[model samples]
Target chain A: MDTDATYQAPSVDEIKTLLTERFAGKVNVTKTETRRVYATLPKEIVHEVCEYIHEKLTFEHISTVIGVDMVDYMQVVYHISNYHTGTMIELTTNLDNHDLHVQSISDIWVGGNWHERETYELFGIIFDGHPKLERLLTPDTYEFYPFRKSYKLRGQE
Target chain B: MAKDVLDIKAESAVMDTDKMWIIMGPQHPFSHGLWTLKIQVDGEIVKDAEPIVGYLHRGWEKEAEARSYPKIIPMADRLCYAASMTYTHLFCMTVEKALDIDVPEKAKYIRIVADEICRIQSHLMWLAAVGTDLGNFTVFLWCMREREFFMDLNVRLCGARMTTNYPRIGGVRNDTTELFDRDVMRCVERFEKVLMDDIVTLIDDSSVFVSRMKGVGYLTREQTVNLGITGPAMRGAGVDFDIRRDDPYDNYDKIDFDVPVMTQGDSYSRYQVRIEEMLQSCKIIRQAVQKVKALGKNAPYRLKVPSNVPAGRSTVRLEDPRGESLMYLISDGTDKPYRLKVRSPIFTNVSAAKPLVQGCRIADVPVVMAMIDMCLGETDR
Candidate 1:
């Protein structure tokens, strides 16, 4: 009980290899920084990837979700962390431009509920299986996707 | 009026008393910020709590896309008025990473000093709020009296008292003086003697206070991580995880301090964790002050960089007084940021309240919430 387990965060390359070996070309992995590992998986495997990281890799918490409107398609970036290993993984999945929908990982991480809703409202990207998809920060009557490229700020001049 | 169309129940003509929806804010005494807690109550017990934020949302991310890189520092300070320095420091660090600017060694120590000081300030403010939430008016008075000490130190270090846009992109706005160091140490000493020793004993010894806090707001260890709870709240659940000790940002790795953790996972345990954390913050400052002093008084505090920042996307996360705050900034070779996404700690912490207070009694809601130490500015941002 007394021995504090000293954890050294794994290298990005190691995580890349681990994911590649596990998924076998189903996903693309890249390293933005030493501590941050970015993996771009298909929309179909988003929930699987989240479950793998949460249950298997022990990445206990989803830090937050960031949605970007990349013109051609919408992208949902998930910042997940494993407290024990002190590793951060950024998982990105693209959504359809016309539909702007993808699978929700809320059940994988209960904390993802509000984050998914925020993404749904701000970027207009829908989480397919979210229990309740509604506006969080914006007013319920307000119907603008504020984070999208189409929505402009008040003082843009 | 709410149930005008519903089938009539015995002795109830207008509303049903079985399961009622109660909007607990925007201006309620229980809510500290301009947000509502829609708690589904069945008489004395709370069935559910749905935290509704956005009452004070200013669309900071949308505004950041138009503003230049350096101008966002002041805006960040408003994210959490109670812990302005922490928010500003996280924002500066994010933008600095995007620009790849090197902060001076002196500035590194100074930023840590400012951050830990804000930790003390925030904890004291929460202490006062917690006291006010409970019927302990004396605790509020004593806490405000003690908070003035650090607020004085904050103003002395930075010109402004509360909204301190002190930490800049590269370093800080200015260097702190030798007198600032002396004043910080003096205040910390008095706080340890007065608040940590005397006031703590006065509160902890009260059987009523202890009984009220203990065994209330039970969040299991697994539930905490699953719900993304961090900071002192997670520590109270017996999870030994602190970003300072684990991540070791700025000069935290150089300093020696223990991450205070308790296993009770209740309001009382959270109270103890924060009180202990203030003492630890003071300890960190004690070491950080010496490190800053050893660097000599005339050492450079901030660095000079170009007016226009380079284009890149970078994100940085740091431990806030409540939990973790992150700023993800994207630049596109322009003076202004392409996009800036802020993941304020309270956003997730407050969201977790629904699950945490699921089966808690109606009376325990305020106690549970005050223990969360929410800042609506941060949550709604």
Candidate 2:
């Protein structure tokens, strides 16, 4: 029933400007299409960026965390959303194989706690500052980080 | 504390205050899925609660990476078994978005209608479950009777009742038959006639039902927002946010429907939201059937889709029966996906049990959790 034409949301460009001003151009938004954004930010600024999204932007809905093994590096994707404005910003951060870790945003979004835990176990990415980061979906004895490209399963390459 | 633990009857004479731990499930009727609730109890009142999930974890996301785009649809269908059509359609929508495939107009209408039918069925399934959970066997029977119509309609539309792997990347798998629209309209009318009077009265007229659901399991609107709760649970907290209208997909924008919100964030309010939602689902199905009929003699349903999709990533969100279901798809310019990440609504919704279930009695756990309508298949996936 929210058919408000006057509900002017902050455009992607406006958000990009805010990011530039806040993080000193350290973040780069790759694409903005239909409420979804693909972006890369400094691993250190991950917490700050999430805080900004949670507080300043009012995008308090942190849906989940996803991690991908991109051969040379790992991609950490956080789906942050605002139900009112219909803004979905997919915050992406690249962590090299050398250091498969990044600061956690669970403090900003408590819902991100489980997501981070699941991501940590499946993709083996360490989320620093997460209070209880452990194996979530997989058992403690289950050794492999099955989501990684290198970890092959039966009947799978 | 140790003294109270040792001398049970003696301590009962005095101000006996002691805390003990209780594991509710890996197998319990209260838990709808393969999850456990560890509660610290002071007598009957819950001191603190922690939800343990992942018992039903099938590693669907990891499995999706190895399988082709189309191959994963069947797996996604099982994401939320109560509403299989919605999950499969959502997966298809994500895949279509990643590949930038244009769905045919008729197929879009079919998807919309089928999705609403699934919603009605899922909500009815939840109502039946909650009824059984709260000792209202009659309500459960009535809800299941009403739900049978929708299940029959689903079978008429697709081949299966629950695991309806009907939606495809480009469009739906097949076209609708003449019996689909006629049968759907007949069912909706018949359902509406009996929905308020016969079925709901079984739960509503009962004084015990009102007392059990009225003010129990309270969640504030602020807490709902901060905790990332979605669907009826969030709406019950008086948040006017419905993804169908706010973030429209599959001709939902064109269809005129109202999103229901209630001020009380209690068990009763959540029930009210679901009841209103079923009516809206019926409305949506009627209008969708009209749209399907308006297409007249001939209309394209299934658009041709390639086995190998172009490389791209898409983050898709939709209001599934339970809540806002999200699918993050990364296609690698091949038939198979690089990574397919699903964030099921019940995962986060179930995680909020520590906040929602705290301070209530152990007996209230079933009513509190049953209102959440947990499906661990999706949560664990």
- Fraction of true contacts retained by every candidate, in order, equals 0.68, 0.70
Candidate 1, residue B97: lDDT: 80
Docking class for candidate 1: medium
Backbone clash count, each prediction separately: 0, 0
* True-vs-predicted CA distance for residue B6, candidate 1, Å: 26
Residue A48, model 1: lDDT of 82
Residues B1-381 of candidate 1: C-alpha lDDT, one tens digit per residue: 978765657456666567988888989777888888999988878898898899888888888777877888888898889999998998888878877877888899899989999999999999999888887888999999999999999889987889999998889998886588889899999999998576788789888778778888899988998888888998899888887787666778898888888998999999999998999999999888888898998888887776676876787889899997777777777888877888877888888888778888887888998888989888878
The residue pairs that clash in candidate 1, if any, are none
Where is model 1 more than 4 Å wrong at Cα?
A1-13, A155-157, B1-17
| lDDT at A72, model 1 | 81
Please provide, for model 2 over B1-381, each residue's C-alpha lDDT reduced to its tens digit, 9 standing for 90 to 100: 775566767657786666899999989988877899999998899989989988888888878877888889899888888989888998989888877878888888899999998999899989989988889898888899999888898889887888988998888888887678899999999998788888777778999988999888999988887787888998999988888998888889989999999999999999999999999988998999999888874788887888887887887889999999988888878999888888888888888898898989988988999888999989998
Error of 1 at A58 (Å): 0.3
Distance (Å) between predicted and true CA of B298, model 2? 1.5
The list of candidate 2 runs beyond 4 A from truth reads A1-9, B1-17
Q: Give the TM-score of candidate 2.
A: 0.95
